[model samples]
Target: MHMTVCLVLAWILIYLCVMKGIKSSGKVMYITATFPYVVTTAFLVRSSTLEGAMDGLYYMISPDLNRLFDPEVWLDAATQIFFSMGLGFGGLIAFGSYNELKNNCVKDTVYLSIANLLTSLYTAIVVFCVIGFMGHQTYMDCLDNDYKTLMTLYPHKYGSLEELKTSIKLDEYIFWMEHQFHHSEFPLLSNASRYCNYKDIIASSAQGTGLAFVVFTEAILQFPFPPLWAVLFFLMLLMLGLGSMFGTLEGVITSLNDSHVITVKKPVLTAVLCGTACVIGLLFTTRAGQYWVSLFDHFAGSYALMCIAFFEIIAVIYVYGYRRFLNDLEFMTTERPGKYWTITWRFVSPVIMLILFFSSIIKSFSHHPVYSAYDPITTAQVDTAYPAWALFVALMLVSLALAPTPFIYFVRKFKIWKIEGDIPAASKCLGSTPSTTYMLKSEPSFNRMVESTASELQTIGMNGPSTNGSARNSENDRKGNGSNRHPPKRN
Candidate 1:
């Protein structure tokens, strides 16, 4: 129920942002993009001091060094780079379009990419450290354990530095860690198992076929808080999530509006669409709601994103031509874009995206190992004919395939709206008069003839003869000396 509420509220926030201009929405995102980094840093520093945290870090890195040999690993890495950097998404293009032409966008992109990578590294360090402290082999294994048991395994320090130092030990800690991994079944484990078993029962008991409230009830126990930090983290997530969703929903809405299928006022449409989503989200209080959310998240979130990214890469680099695209890039950076960038944009990124897309497809076909504690006696009922997960994946693909239909129709009927029946004034004025603002067909300002003419004219008649007393006396002497000019002087 809480998850449903969060998702709905998140969607509503995005819708609100769409009603307003995206430029106005970005101030909130600047904080959202940085909050996770801060939290991860604090956690990393704290976890590194824990007794078994090193063990967790070791296991995380130990995942077959040979996995690097597999092409799939390279593909996965590429996908992560693309997804984390928000590449191949029109969001970057749209945001870049809004940015002032003079802004140094290449530097900003470089900085943002590095920041994202550093944050991911920090998060991995913290998570691995927590795993080490708990002596777990993998994250999924830890998740399977009782949440309370995992919480207690952490070395919480409340004393002076010396006391805290004394609490850290090799032998005693190893003994406890061994016992944790080998012997005890956590008391809460049984309770959690019961909750999972009761999922269907709880859903049936709800007003309709809704989500089990037990999941939401469990999550409230997991809120990590230093009241202020909690507030900051939650608010930051809200902003980040809203920013992403707003960008996506805006695309969807704009596409619809352009198609002329939706003619309502922008604000009104925004409110109605968002409000309807909220009301529909209330259905998440049932078993079906949980099922559907999981489906949408897994399929749309994973596979659909892959498809969209690949398409975006092809469209921009190949279809649009990287040479022409370089013109747009020049406005964003101080340095002249080099041959290396052209090569990467035209060839490398697309190849990477294609590789990742194929890997995802192959992985999807492979069987996922599923285990369950409950196998009912007697005639066992397969609650679902196929895994509910398949349903979700199918729905995701269907949704994506349907996304382009409106665009096709919109392109076909684009001429239906003709606000100006006559030619625009600017077009009419094009040949009729010379525009003061335009310098079309103007001569080159630099000219040798004009420059020489100006220099020659600067001294005017001064070069011909001096008019000063000395020059006048010299001229009279020349005539009196009776040279060729003596006859003229006599007159």
Candidate 2:
């Protein structure tokens, strides 16, 4: 019930931000996006005073080179990079379309990428410091309280650390301290020592989820103005989450509108999308919601992301043609891509993405997908595979996400869902014709969309919307009557 209310509130917030298109959401971002920095700085300052916070700073720790060969590490890194840079989600493209035709997107992208990297590093450091403090507290708690009880249960000959240190190896000491015997009575096992193992403590501490609650809950209990920073912290998370949703929902909304299958006002469409999503999302608020989230994430989050990214790259570079893309980029930015771009886009990116996509597919089939599960009795997190029916549902999600790529390809290839003036299957599928492509056409600038000249449009294209009275003259040209001289600007 709590989750349901929260989900509804979130959807309502999303609707308010996005309902009027970017106008309302753009204003809301001022609070959502910037407040996190303020909260984080506060955390950083408070965290430094923590008794053993530095113990959590993985940055100060030496690198473990042995993990480089790990496949899981590579896959995880790929997923992080994709999501971090907003590569596969279509958000970047959707948002970028709003930019002016002459916008220096190259510079903007580079700056944003650097900012994103730094932001991720900063956020991780904050999380690490907090986790480190938690571990230190955990260790101290076990020492202060649990040690006395364990000693009473099983008397150790060496009542103190100095004597116990000589009797047992550190490995055995760790086993006894962590209660590796699963809370059972063992004759050789003794009480905990005063010496705290910071290494083991930090290593065993969980990061990410539920961490913020623990951190802020403590702040609310211990700090002055208890709820201030706690509220800010939660709001930071809220904005960060909604910020991503803003772009994703916009992409979905825009695509549906552009599909020519659905016709509705932006407000109506936004409400419908938000309402439908809220209904679907209610499943996530259920008791089985965690399992459903895991299932969707396993299939859609990883596998389907790679599939979408791989095809998008292929369609643009391979189907669209390298030279044509360069030409399009030049037309938009008035700058041609360099040799480095050519090499990476045509060869390096495709090869790497292909390998990763196929490998994920193979791994998914070879072994069952597992999710993180907690054992209440053992007080430990464990990996558990999905049940057979759950696995089937997961696969269906993957298939549903992926089926459209090939389905649309064949549809367009055979003219099943023919548009009035789409390029032929040979031209589209095989990239046989360059002149018919949008490569030579200029992407319409909202400001100058009213007044496009023959000089502005390098070629006559039939696919874009009708731009009859479009001119280079003035804003009033936006209302100009149809003049067959200029073909429609690409939508």
Candidate 3:
């Protein structure tokens, strides 16, 4: 019941913020976007007072150079980078589309990129400090209780309890004791150990939900006014979640509104979208919600994002033509892109993404897919191979995202599923868009481009060829220093 209420309240807040479109969401961003930084800053200061905070920071900086060779490590790093920067998501593009044509996109990109990188690094340092504290606290608690417990269970190992205390300095005796009580000796120890060594905590680092719920919650209890810190931390999380949600929902709403797919008011569309999503979200509020979430994220999140992102880079850099893109940027900024942009677009980004995407897939097939399964009785997680049904579900989830490209290709090419081009509702469909304009005005290139889009270009560009289809004019270019000769206008 509590979960249900929380779920509803969250959706209600989302609806209220986005109901009026960017006007409402923009105002809310003042709080939602900035509150996380405040909480993170506070935590950074407070973490310094913790018993093992320095240990955690050191754990973070210390590198595992060997892991660089592991495909899984690269895949994991790519996943974090993708989600952190909101790559493969159309949210940032949707928000940027609102800016005027002459907006300083290059400057915005550089500043935001640097800010995001620094923020992610800072947050990692802070989180590791808390995790270090958690590890140290656990070790201390174990030390406090192990003496009495060890005396009761293994009195035969020593002459007396006092003897056992003095012999703790003896490596053999301590190792034997850890075997009886903890079984957490260096060679034997894994993340499943009840007590952790702070130095070894990197292997057991809690992340995502575990970091937020278990590590942070326990660490907060060690602070002076746990309740106050708890409130602030959770409130920060709420805002962080809402900040991301706003962009995702805004992207969906704006695309639908711009596409002119269905005739509906913005407020009504926003309500319907949020309401439907909230109802679907209830599945995630159940006792098995975490498992369901894990499944969804495993299948639909990483690989799908990689696939979409790979294709997006291909579309923009290769199919759309690189020189054309660079030309557009040059026209808008009045300065040509440097070698850095060229290297990233032409080679680096795509190669890295493609390698990561395919390497992950190869690794999955090579080894059975295993997820860390929670053991309720012991309150520990065990790495368990996905069951048959779970594997099927994972396959289906991936298919839902990826099978469409080929399906649409077959349907469109074979004309098996004919789209009535004359239909009124289809007037503003993407395939039939008249919103685009040409850049390369060579007769062959322009005609080829027009022919590719076909009849749709006829609606608006019918008279375009008659006059001067070779070039188009400067509506805002002069005011903005030739802001691009042919910027595609979207409603």
Candidate 4:
């Protein structure tokens, strides 16, 4: 019931913020977007003072060139890029569609891309710094525990300063201390020492919600004034989450509006959508919610994203025709895309995306879906393998998300084939004609408009302003009379 209330409140907040479209949401972003950066910067600055903070920073930025050779690493990098840029999600596209027809999207794209990359790097720095402090604290705690044990066991061994120096070989003592603690018995201490040496807390980090709610919260608690920083950190996370939700929700609302499938007032439509989503979201608040969330995240969140992206690229580049796409861009931007953009859209991106998609599928099948289940009383890790039926359900969820891509593709193909079947055999035998010919054939009215405009210009040039008035009047009459007619062919 508590979770239900929270979910309802969240949806209410989202609906209130975005019901008026960008007008309300854009104003909300002033705080939601900027406040996180301020909080993150504060965390980063505070973390720098902690011991071993540089180690964390070094681990983050120092590249292992050999890791680049691993396909999994490349896949991970691509996934990060896709998520950070919100690519393939339809959210960015929906947001951009709200802009004016001639908005400078090229500039906006470049700026936003760079900003996204920088923000990701900055957040990594802040996260790693906290991790570094956590590592330092963990090591100290382990050492303290070991010292207490030794004092309890052999108090007389350290009774005199001279005896203490003579009896303890520092290297031997250090070795014994590390070897004595069983990781299961002292999980935090054991892991802390390992993380300190390797400087790679990220490797042990949790995925999805665990990283945000568990790992980050754990790190925040290590700071001075834990309550204050914890509040600030979570508040920042909340704002960022709300901001993202706004975009995604707005995308759905805008899509429905554009489709004309919901013929209600905007606010009424928004309320219906948000209310439905809230009710559906109640499933995630159940006792088994975590497992369901894991399933959804694995199948819908990861696999469906790549599949959607692959189809989107194929549709734009192949179905839409590359040259026609470029012409559309030129119309909006007044500048044609350069060679690099052309090559990427046509070849490079599609190939890379296909590889990633296949690789993900292969990886998914190779391992059964397993999530960590902890004992509530003792907090010991228990491996929980998803049941076979759950796996099937996950696959179904992925299929559902991916259903539209091929369904739409085949429907479009069938329509094209049906149209071509009506064309004469002779024209069919001539093979695929240029898209320009097809365009002209499809829009006879456009051809007439062009011809009429050309004829008007020619008359003005040939006769000058003395005869311009009469020529213009006649042309206007012709346009008014048969604006929809194809102009008669000139020999």
Candidate 5:
């Protein structure tokens, strides 16, 4: 019930924000977009002062140039770029469609792309700082706990606490302890013993939501005013999530409206769409929600995104004709696109996307879907693989986004063939086919009449009237100039 209420409220908020289309969302975005950055900046400033923060920053920016050659690194980088920019998703296209024809889309794209990358880097800095703090805290906890144990166990060897502390070399002591207590009967002792090593503390940190909620929250609790920082951190996350949801919902609404799939008032359509999404989202709120979310994240989010992107590039550059697209851009912008844009669109983007798409497919098939399952008692990841059937279902989920492209393409082609048989020649290039010749041929008489009328009008204009008739002829021509040009041909 709590989940349902949250879901409904979320949809309601989204509906309210975008019910009036881009106009409403555009106003709301001014706040939603800028506020997160402010929050992120605050977090970054606050986190930088924490103990061991520089270690995190070093870990993040220490570049191994050799990693560039690794396909896995490239794949990860490409995935981050795609998702961060919301490129493969229909949301960016839907948002852009609302722009005026004269709007400088090139400028907007360049600015937004740069902003997105910078924002990602900034967020990473904040995240790793928090992680570094966590690492530091964990290391201290392990150090103190192990130090107490050492004092308790070897009090006789060292005469007094000060003497033992002065005599012990911390690093060598930790190494000796870890080797000594490697398989202690007490689980807590064993775990604490392991953490005495700095590498173990670093290894314990997680990624994704675990890092956000678990690790960061843990770091927040160690701060001067825990509650204040906690609230601020959570608020930042909520705003970020809401901003993303707004764009995603807007994409669905815009697509539906453009396709004429739901012919209703905007508010009514918004309600229906949001309500439907909320209902579907209920699945993720269930007990096994994490599993389902992970499944979707793997198959639908990652794999399908790349596939959709690949096809989108192909359809635009190859199917729609890149040169014609550029011409259309020229018409709108009053300037031709540069060779850089043309080359990237025509070749570079498509080839790289195609490679990524196939690589993802190969990777998906090669490895079984195995998510880190946490043990409730230990809060440690268990080595448990998802069932085969669940992976199969995930594959089906991937097809949900991908299956429509080819299906819609064939459907459109069939409709064209049905309406205009033998009109569009097979050899004729897409978007470059001459005006339907078959339609023109079928109305030869009307065409001839129109041609004759145009010729007569031209002759009248060329052959100057007699001096007496000149004024009256010119007056008639002035009154009927538009009609004389090219009247609509009747069947």
Candidate 6:
């Protein structure tokens, strides 16, 4: 029920922004894009100051330099970069389209990169800090623990069984439980003891997997100003998620819209697409809701972004012509784009993308564990099954692959997709528009007819100087003579 509401509300907000067009959606994007940074940063600062936080920070930053040589680490980093920056997938291009033609794409690109990097760093800190407090040795181990033990320990342990059963202050019970975990060395001790006490370990394990729903709800309920804080937190998350989603929807829609096959009526088209999304979302409300989401997320959110980023790099630096790209940078920063960006986009981006693509492909094909938990539908299996979720992801990838077919055909047929003939190109659509001449000449027949009609009007009502005769026109009047001025001449 909770996830359902969140999903519904999220789609509702995204659809509303689409109704406003890409330009208006910029406000939404800006807010959403910048928000997670603030939250994560705040949490990071708090986390970093906690005991043992430095150890976690060190663990994150001091990556095995050998991991760099392994190619997989580089791939992971690149994938993270692409996803965080909203690169590749039509999101960036669509957002860029919404920008002023004169707006600096190079600067925007750099700024976006820096912002994403900073956010990731902050997130890492927050993640590590929490893990450090939990005394987990590695990220994978922490993930295995499912981030629940800390949040739920207090609620389950601090309150007596009677207190838990009889308390009207459910929030207090949760708080009490969390406090126990916060102050206790149970998590660390569990790691040290290898969870020898099997019963307690199993209980802790159960809490970890269910934390997203259970403990998170408990934390929210226990807020000092529950109503206000809950409103703020949910609204903030909604804005952030919607902003990201708006970008994704806009990218896909623009890719189709620019082809001219979808028609140019943006308002109606946007509403329809968003409505369709809501209907699709309804599929996740059933018994396999989580499965559905995970499927879409795995494919569309991860690998798709990598592919998109690869193509984006190719388009920007190679196909667009690097010197021309340099000029875009010069216009924005008042200095030429550095050599580093050129190299990054050209050589580095593609290589990184390839590595990530191959790594995922290899992983999928390998006999490695699929790492999933038991659900109502299926027990925990060694290999992830081709469940509904997998099918969902497959559909998304297939759609992405096939999406350009009609678009390519349309552009070839109508020539509406050219940057000069079409509009400004960018990763994110940014209030982009057709060229001014295109706008003026769009109604070419009407313009031509108007000009012809004006000319014909000029030829009428000029027959004579005294009235409306052709003989006494401006030429005759200018010469101080009128061919039909004399009445004798009329006879």
lDDT of 5 at 435: 22
lDDT of 5 at 232: 79
> Where does model 2 exceed 4 Å of error?
59-61, 145-197, 214-224, 421-491
What are the lDDT scores of the predictions, listed in order?
Answer: 0.48, 0.65, 0.70, 0.66, 0.67, 0.52
Q: Per-candidate TM vs. native?
A: 0.57, 0.79, 0.78, 0.76, 0.79, 0.60
* Candidate 1 per-residue lDDT over residues 1-491, each given as its tens digit: 67776767676666656665454456656666667667657657766786656765776676667677665566556656756666645456545433344467778878988888877777667655654544422222333343333344432632443453355343443443344532343343333422221112222222111111322122222335446544644554565566665655555544343333565665677677778767766766575665556455445555566667666667667765565456545523436689988888778866876776676667655645222222357433234344766665566565765476455446434855442211111111111111211221131221222243344222212132111111011222322112221111111
User: If both were scored by lDDT, which would come out higher, candidate 3 or candidate 5?
Assistant: 3
For model 3, state the Cα shift of residue 475 in Å. Answer: 20
Off by over 4 Å in 3: 149-196, 376-378, 403-436, 439-491
Q: What is the lDDT of residue 199 in candidate 2?
A: 71
- Stretches of candidate 1 above 4 Å error? 1-8, 13-18, 69-79, 136-236, 250-266, 276-285, 288-294, 331-336, 366-491
Model 2 TM-score, all chains together: 0.79
Residue pairs with backbone atoms closer than 3 Å in model 4 (clashes) = none
Which TM-score value belongs to model 5? 0.79
**Residue 419 local lDDT, model 6:** 30
lDDT, candidate 4, 1-491, per-residue tens? 99899899999998999787766788899999999999989988888888868877877787889977665566667767777777777788767754544456789999998899899989988877866666666666655555555555556657754465456565655555556633544344443443223333444556567777876788777677999998898889789878888778777775565443355766788888889989878999999888788778767777787778888889778876899777656645669899999999999998987887787677656887676777788676567788899888988998988997777567546664232212221111111123333443454443443454566334222222221122011122222112111223343
For candidate 4, the per-residue lDDT at 96 reads: 71
Better of 3 and 4 by lDDT: 3
Better of 2 and 3 by lDDT: 3
Query: Which stretch of 10 consecutive residues in model 1 shows the poorest summed lDDT?
Result: 464-473
lDDT of 5 at 256: 62
Itemize residue pairs with steric clashes in candidate 3.
none
Cα TM-score of candidate 6: 0.60
What value does the lDDT take at residue 4 in candidate 1? 77
On residues 337-448, what C-alpha lDDT tens digit does candidate 6 reach at each position?
6778778767886886787778766766574324344555654323365755566557667577546645765774686754331222111121112222223334443234
